[model samples]
Target: MTATTPPAVSMLAPARPRRPRAARVLLAAACAAVFLWPVVMVAVGAFRTSLPGTPGGWTVTKLVDTYLSPVTYQVLAQTVFFAVSVTVVSTLLALFFAWVVARTDTPLRRLVTPMMGLVLAMPPLFFAISWGMLGNQRVGLLNTVYQWLTGAGHGFFNVESWFGLILVSSLKAASFSYFLLLGPFLTMDRSLEEASLTAGAGRARTFFRVQLPLLTPAISGAAFLTMLAFLEAFDIPEIIGIPAGIRVLPTQIYSHINATYGGQYAEASSLAMCLMLIILALVAVRARLLGGREFTTVSGKSYRLERWKLGRARWLGTGGILGYGLLALVLPLAQLYLGSLQSLFGRYDGFSLDNYAAVLDDAEITGAIRDTALLAVLGGLVTVVVCTGLAAVLRTRGGLAERLVTISVWMPMALPGIVLGLGIMWSFLSVPGLNQLYATIWILLVGLFIGAVPVGMRAAEGALAQIPRDLEEAARIGGASRVRAFAGVVVPLIVPSLLSGWLLVAIMISGNLAIPVLLASPTSQTVSVEVLKLYQSGEISQAAAVFCVISTAMAAVGVVVGVVRAVLSRRTLLRGTG
Candidate 1:
């Protein structure tokens, strides 16, 4: 009877940590205070006729009146129209291409995959600028090419309108949705389809009846994200939409704050509130759709590798993939490279290195690039560390505090960048001594940091969830302290995830446009803002050169990182066996 004693439980486990828990609570509260304080001040100021101590009367009634005005409604409608169009168009395009590459044995998939990644690395504004350079009404480079080729007239390149804006936005954003859906396509269980086929169903019928049903989550998620992306778009629409008399919520807010309207902070705040509400509603719907139950199509069991015979259709599908890759990646990048080499617009008299020389020679341009690189490197490292810390704490704490922190990190992701930047500006500028940072490069970094945190946290959280808790328990039982256990065991285990998180944050920070535009000064201009400015001034050649340099450099860096990651992963796998 005395032979079988149950496993001893440690009654003297770590005390319910009062100091650590209280400090975490206080830190979270303080961070929240810093983040939301600006929006609160703007909200209050938005209602008042002027600053509280100014001569005019102060009242919340003004906010109501401003929102109800006819002009606001018109702008709101235009914003919604553009966003919806972009979302629908982009989602469809992404779905078609994803199916082509994932379901069928499409040709050049390896090449197409890397190209999509490259395009994703470029900011949205870059596409608008590239298109503008080649398609603007009077001096578009593509129109010039057409004239040279087919003797076509000048009226063909009319990207200065709403149609052009929508097309460019949708095309540029489609890459991300394509990437999102690829995951589902790769992991989907083939047996489900085989079962339908074995039951005498046709291939197309089985696809529609079985495969598509399992992919609903991925489809829904991509559409939701695309909608958010289109809704919050600023740089592309601002650059192209203005010429077509099209105004979205972001540009309207910009006009309210920066245009000759004498700085209507109150009205702008009200508009921002409206934008926040719309985004929140979308986020809520998306969360509800993606919430319950895992959608794991792949399970560890017997299976069959099913492939459809494309025959003649195979080449056509392959051609489509190649065409998209060329249009979306090759052509644009080629234009950028060629434009960078020529010193002046359409002056192919001779090639000169002056454009690149000028970009490098200017102290301001050099400084901005340096600042951008520094921010990307530092911000990426910091964001990954924070994300890993939060993910670790959440695994251990699993309470109200964990839930609150998780939600707080995602809050910034839901708010548009312009909205968040405006809130930060309003909140910090109103403070006594903090306004000095408003006009500096630091502001740009802070805004990017806010944007970076949410995505980084999500990536790290996904990786952490894959790890088993037994690893940590085993370490603790071996006499390791909590911090030591995490550092020695958890950190090494999640290195691949940490590196991935770092890469994502870096790419995002490198291409960020909205936050940098609002935060950077004339002297502290980033490459993205510079490209927009050059495009606006009809300096197509210069803009193209700048873009080429940046993109090429980034692509090279990405290759290095990818190789390192592959090596590290292999090493880890080998060591685990040993």
Candidate 2:
């Protein structure tokens, strides 16, 4: 009988790569220049101590001034409070909901994950604008209904308060945390829980003593990452906190650049550096906390957990899921729809298509829409290509330089949007010939591209990691070029995941408010920036209309892409079948 090669043996066979060393070096250099250099430029820009367009010598004066200011201390303390509270509240909420879905016999459990995904996909800018309308104290839907029900003269609720800021932020944060924790819950082994129950422990005691400890690592990791996200949050804070006189690091940096008359480029750079340092320290602590402590539930082999029979509590679980969907997704979107049909923001008696028509007819809104579309497509594709190329290069190439380049490509994970935007702006301005690039649409493109690198890189790397090098080796041995080998053998294996990731990246770029706020000029403004301008310009009803248009478009694209991805993911080739 003819002997066939064992799968493991074939996978471990030595292989020669056809890719040229010079080409690899050049590609690595290009990636570093695009994805890595701008980060270093952030620190370099902080010490420039000059106006953005004007040339000047480097100095530490601005950095020293920002570091010594008492107001900086106040902002720091408040930011910590806000970040910590949001983290705790969001984590607890996600843990509870995730448990209801993953551990218990929650009715309609499958619906929970998808709904949360939708919530996570909905941009914070959309919520900030929606809630700004829903809780306006004067004519907000909530307050309007409240006064009618209670027979009060004035509405009591205001979204522009500490309570509102945290509420809005926590809702967004919880959706993300739920997804992060869901995988852990799903993968957990049931032996410990089974043992605890057999020993006559109550469910509560078992959860607290046995299961919760197993989940502590995931919970802690989620908390730190969530804290970092909100630390540089701008939309909710800018819309809600500023009216309450709340100053977080992100908003403070924005004020220095855009809110001030002439703009303080030097001060903005200094503040960006400070926030950068703070996030770096947090990231370091998080790394230390998680190092060598990735708690795996499966001991030796994987086992399944039977969903607890919750008896009558299953309906209660379903109710909780419905409640989250109502508040997080349904209510705000409902308010936005209702508000969009009105000619005036708060008036409810009469409705019109005038706002929609006007928005569609306006040259500026149309321009912004066109610009947003161009950027989302161009930026998303560029990010995916560059990141995909980097992932492939890392898999085959080995050197200290390549590893350093790899780190640089992934370093944007710790960066907040406005900080990175400021860095890019300063980086552009610091060079003489490139100063003109700052005022054009191209700068926003670069900012958006880099803003997406960390996520895109991770997605690409994860996809590439799953694919065996053996397939590519076989292709190379058949006389295929390295590029041809990858294109022929590896791309098909990971295309669905890559396409799914690319779609999400495109949506994110479409609705991105923070980066565009810093980098966009009047002519280059995107749909998201237009929404803010409309709202802030006292054109609330029109702003709602704009959001409705964009959200509807994005949602349709998301649904279609999701379906295509699902179909593509079903290919048997992905599973080593036909």
Measured by TM-score, the strongest candidate is 2
What tens-digit string does per-residue lDDT give for candidate 1 at 36-55? 55456656667667632244
| lDDT measured at residue 504 in model 1 versus the true structure, 0 to 100 | 85
Clashing pairs in 1: 38-427, 46-266, 340-545
**lDDT of the structure predicted as candidate 2:** 0.85
Candidate 1 Cα outliers beyond 4 Å, as residue runs? 1-4, 11-19, 34-42, 51-57, 195-202, 287-302, 563-578
lDDT of 2 by residue, 280-386 (tens): 89888878877886566766654877889999878988898888888788889999999999879889878989999999999999999999999998998888888
Best by lDDT: 2
Residue 53 lDDT, candidate 2, scale 0-100? 65
Error of 2 at 153 (Å): 1.4
